[model samples]
Target: MASDPFDRPNRNSSSFILVGVPSLETSPICLGILFCSGYIITLVGNGGVLLVIGLDNSLRDPVHCFLGMLAVIDVVMVTTIVPKMLSVFWLNSTQISYMACFVQMFLVHSTTSEESGVLLAMAVDRYVAICHPLRYQAILNRQTIAQIGLAIVVRALLFMDPLTGMVTKLPYCHSHVVPHSYCEHMAIAKLACANPRPSGLYSVAGSSLIVGMDMAFIAVSYGMILKTVLGKKSCWKAFSTCGCHICVILLFYVPGIVSIYAQQFGSGISVHAQVLLADLYLTLPTVLNPIVYSMRTKQIRQAVLKMLFSRKVHA
Candidate 1:
């Protein structure tokens, strides 16, 4: 009679090994350089946005408020994953303790949820600004934005707690090798000796709900924004208002959705390609958001220029 492979004795599964893009293992230095460069840009770009918006009272409007919140979330998302990834890429430090692995999983997923929530809130802000220009101030004032931000954080943690908790409770008697850069939930779940379908289903359902609802709302918001703008004589100007946010929305959702599903079901795709997509999905948006906003939104562009000019004078 055949026996269960999972029941067989094996080496220590106390800590999981993260094999970050196995194809790139031989070129660790190149991968290290790429991630290091991206991490630096993400930090400087998002940090500059936060700093500029904080110091400039003129940039304290609701749109900029949401942008600042997004900057904070981007910083959290990248910081949670990038340093560990650098260690794996550069120093060959790939083992992550069980507790530490779950912590990273929680942070990565929770921050992704928070970013989605912030994007939804920003979509609403755009809707109000374009569709109800007169009521924009009363609709998304300081207090309301604060409440929304609080809700975003609370909802993200509350939703992610159960998912991570379930994965943590799983008996990981199987191989402790994770095939991705960070402690991605499903990647870890698949390593458990027990059936991982329940956790996988929950993760898929939760992710689908968050992404679906947020994308639907954003689409509807833009639809209404488009309708309102087209009726006006200054349609071009109105559309220009949403240009940066639209670009940001595309950057956030498109790659993310593709990478997630590819990891889950794209058997035809190579694991290395899947890992690369996931890594880029986690990172590219953070590096691009500030640059996109700076180029598209006049107010932010001016504020950033002003900050740089003043710094030059001080120098």
Candidate 2:
């Protein structure tokens, strides 16, 4: 009680059990294979993006830098949750130690919050490029970009630190069985012997203030970008520049909002459907982010293609 259990976990059992996709009980093998394929695709795509960006000196613009950052975020995000989910499905090994659960929940939440901030930063980069093209380089130089990255990291750390403390301090008593596929704040907190209301409230507040503010900033940035490029050709080009990022944003945030709302308010949707939505929110972006960026951004595609071609030539 004096110090948090996160200093060391005290648990009812040796490990917590994850009841992953109860709906897949009849077809666990197939579901596991599907998820494994998804995870592999995500790795290959994002890895390729990172490789392309790192190899090309000409592609070192702020946009490319952010793309690499996003790829890293997507990679880490999937790595945090998907492996355990796959293990649960394939190996029937659902028991995760409390410390492991704590680590997973921390990485998952922090990376998610950081990615939201990165999305806002990307919007700002686009706004500068479209509206203040002449000043874009001066405004978003390497130092400035580094500063933005640092700020995003610190913001994520500060925002999620309290939530981690709240979730970790609670005494988990008899029930160590988490109903979900992976360790999340609510899932872990519900196992606590003490009240879990504060953890839930903290999560809701974190989503509203952290994610909500980032979305608001991105929206305002895009609005200004639209005004700056209102003419026929300018409008097309400007929107073209940001089109991929917009799609990625929508993919990342919209499903999460819908899933949260459905879970909270939509009585008509089934529990399994809600869980599926939650899973998709994390996995969908990882799978599609590279495709959307590489296809829409010509420079990225060219860079990736050139690198692959050279590798094949040397081999």
Candidate 3:
């Protein structure tokens, strides 16, 4: 039988569970409405991104292909965490079964890692196209893109597997009430009775290695791309083409970096603030990615319009 973490006795029982954090105070009606709205928006936006990329032959190139995979990853990630989280909030239940909690932890971490990998792959794609235009098609062919996507999934699975196992193995002698909204690694680790130094060390080390290497590669790639773009006669046009990608990169990376540091260093930020920021990181990309592609990429916009109008005509 699985032990209940909350039932465990501790000296600082009051502090074991977070105090002063505002409870979910909204009426059930409001909670239901908000949950439905969030789910619908995320689903439609991510679904549209996948549909547009898949159906439009012109958008099947290396860059859009990567973007499409990102859309899929976002959809999977949100589906895994947000709905259940909304349930917890609406029901006002801080308790999650040990197995369910670990499963959620695994899915969230895996998808997040995969998303980071996908972003890094997109950066490499941009680097190849802008910095080495002549070799772009040859290097980033269809098979190569598929291979990169596979690599992202494989890497995420491998990286998160051991961490999930480590987390599930820890004795939960503290309170089960997670400090934050989700089953995040840091939050869960704090509840463990076992010495979490190893887990913390592993998390920081692994995250730093992966994020650092990826960021370095992206930085080098962008540096070369900038040099190449500046050398071009139509530098403005070159910049315009890469602008959307740059926007997406910044949007995805900046919040992630902020959240990681805030969570790690025990910044004095309130639990509510951290939860809101974490939700934003999970959601914004789902909403923004499709909008950015539709507005910025002429091919994607035309494809979306054609699909919408065709559906209307058929109806």
* Local distance difference test, each candidate: 0.84, 0.82, 0.73
* Candidate 2 worst ten-residue window by lDDT: 4-13
Q: Write the per-residue lDDT of candidate 1 for residues 81-120, one digit (tens) a residue.
A: 9899999988889889999999999998898899899889
How displaced is residue 244 in candidate 1, in Å? Answer: 4.9
| lDDT of residue 241 for candidate 3 | 54
Compute each candidate's TM-score over C-alphas: 0.91, 0.90, 0.83
TM-score of 1: 0.91
Instruction: Point to the candidate with the largest TM-score.
Output: 1
The clash count of every prediction, one per candidate, is 0, 0, 0
Best by lDDT: 1
* Candidate 1 clashing pairs, residues 3+ apart or interchain: none
lDDT of 3 by residue, 7-34 (tens): 5555444332321123544444565466
Off by over 4 Å in 2: 1-11, 237-244, 260-269
The full ranking of all candidates by lDDT, starting with the best, is: 1, 2, 3
Q: What stretches of model 1 exceed 4 Å from their correct place?
A: 1-11, 231-233, 237-244
By TM-score, is 1 or 3 better?
Answer: 1
Arranged by TM-score, best first: 1, 2, 3
